[model samples]
Target: MGNLSRLLKESWTLVEEQQDKVAGYFYARMFLSNPELRDLFPTQMDVQRARLLGAIVTAVQTMEDPDRFEEYLQSLGRDHRKFHVEPQHYDLVGNALLEALRTFAGERWNIEYDQAWRDGYAVIAKKMMAGAAADTNPPYWNAEVLAHERRSRDIAVFTCRPFYPLDYRAGQYLSIEVPKYQPRLWRVYSMANAPRPDQTIDFHVRALGAGYVSGALVRRTRPGDLIRLAAPMGSMSPDHSSNRDVVCIAGGTGLAPVKAIVDELSRYNRTRWVHVFFGARDRDDLYDLADLNAMANKYPWLTVVPACSDDPGFDGEQGNISEVIARYGPWNDHDFFVSGSPAMVKATMRTLAGLQVPSIRIKYDAFTDG
Candidate 1:
């Protein structure tokens, strides 16, 4: 690690213990210093606070790999365009962040730490601005909802057509802004199918009490509704170079990206065997069973297993998806794709590790804000 990386990691270790306080301080300082900027953020600040701290932590953690760090910053910079972020705003935010770190650091804050952060922030700002400048596409795309189907009480599947062509790979995700809600509030959702010539995309949304965007999408959105979609982001996708057998595990709405990968595989008529485990709490929660089964039937190389944790009467695998996957065992040779709630993903990762799967063979996009 470089000097700046070491400084950032050391300072972050101190701030992480009081992460909530530091995030609260940073936003408080920002809003207080520039009241007009408050309008650009969400009305509820809790999730936003967590997101800010998480982003900083991730940036620091990845700084050791310059290529990865630059890519992440570029993506973040491009995505921030949707929020109407301007070049001047970066300086203001950086100042507030340094102030927060200083306040939290107390006597521990030194000239070296301050200088290191300034240098680091400069590098971040330059790369982010460069990313924004290089973008040929519009900051955001206007999409009209073409279809909205409530697959279950809490989950809905939406198909939308962008006013302009949206170019993305099979397993990427897009940040969507619903104007009816907080105008600037955005949520990320995985594109649930492979890119098509028509420029239409599918998203599977599950409403959570704290998910304002998801609630609006599942309950208030309808056909003809227009929403804004940011540029596609995420690096989760199949490794086409390797024809190894694939194992996909999804929980709840996490099925979206998994379905997208499978769609791509089916379209290409891939010869590799794919084992998919779809997990739900009950039989009623298996909303996409028919479609998945249909796909499995059409693609003989694909196997779809629906596992229900609470439904004993269901005539299929009975257990949490991760537990069911454990029963199959010996997944050391297969490439694994996992998605769902953080708990589900973490649990499945543990199961995969127990099965001796190499970390490099496991792939998923866990950074998108949901």
Candidate 2:
């Protein structure tokens, strides 16, 4: 590509050999220098270090491929916006990274190599700054939860005091806090309703096998639960100005964010051409069908498609939501929004890729991991 890109490629060739120590030193140095950041991380530093190491390796690998490296970096740059990571954070990280490299390189470490690494970090920081500025980003914890509702066994909706007084653009989420079995447990839930300042936002939480907070929230929490919360996050909202066709695929409580998105579309009188595919088990286990049905009837622009994987009476569609999308055919023109269990999100994303949808247009809200 260019001088910086070529330098990046050349330096990264040594990454595979030094990957483990690079990540190790980076964290060890950073945590030592700024002990405050320790609270931002999981309690188990070793485990979290491994995770960061893996993530760094993956990121470096992606950068090695020049085809769409900028686009991928831009996506990560956008993601960091949710954390409210600033330019100073990058500078701090870069210092730690270089120190780690120097320690690992030992006698071999030279000023020239250090300069290259510093230059690389500066390039990435500049790009991240540009992306942060252009994205119209907001703070991570700027909103408070006003109210919530229990729609089904594992699905609940919460109303939020928006950081900006306006309607949520659909498919967005809020980071929230709840009593945790662990030392610190905070999670995110998608808004199930359109932006309604006077009312509560909605969230659908599917209890995983042993989801302590989710189970308690679904089974125990009530109207006036004093919930700790962050502002709305995620970039999966639909653009109202564009009439490009859209499809939503959701499973379990993944429907919460999808429903919020659909509700937003309905408010703009843009529902008819949109198709929503929701998958679940039996009738009793199904969530928000009634609300979705009412929306469909109210707006000619929308179509709700529910699929049951196990219900014998499921007369509409059978199998996974992604499968339903495939059978319908011609998804090239439509943007795909996927949410659900990690497996469902992963599988549906694969299916969408196989169907040839542009990566940018295919969005997902990973609800379970929070």
TM-score of 1: 0.95
Q: What stretches of model 2 exceed 4 Å from their correct place?
A: 1-29, 39-92, 95-117, 123-154, 162-168, 179-185, 209-220, 270-272, 281-285, 310-315, 353-361
Model 1 Cα lDDT, one tens digit per residue, 1-370: 5878999888777777898999999999999999989987988776778776676667778888988899888888888888778999989989999999999999988898898888888888888888888888899999999999999988899999999888888778888889977477888899999998888899999887788888899999989999999988777888888888999999988899999999988877557899999999998889898999999999999999999999989999999998999988477688889988888888888888888889989987653324
User: Which ranges in model 1 have alpha carbons more than 4 Å from their true place?
Assistant: 367-370
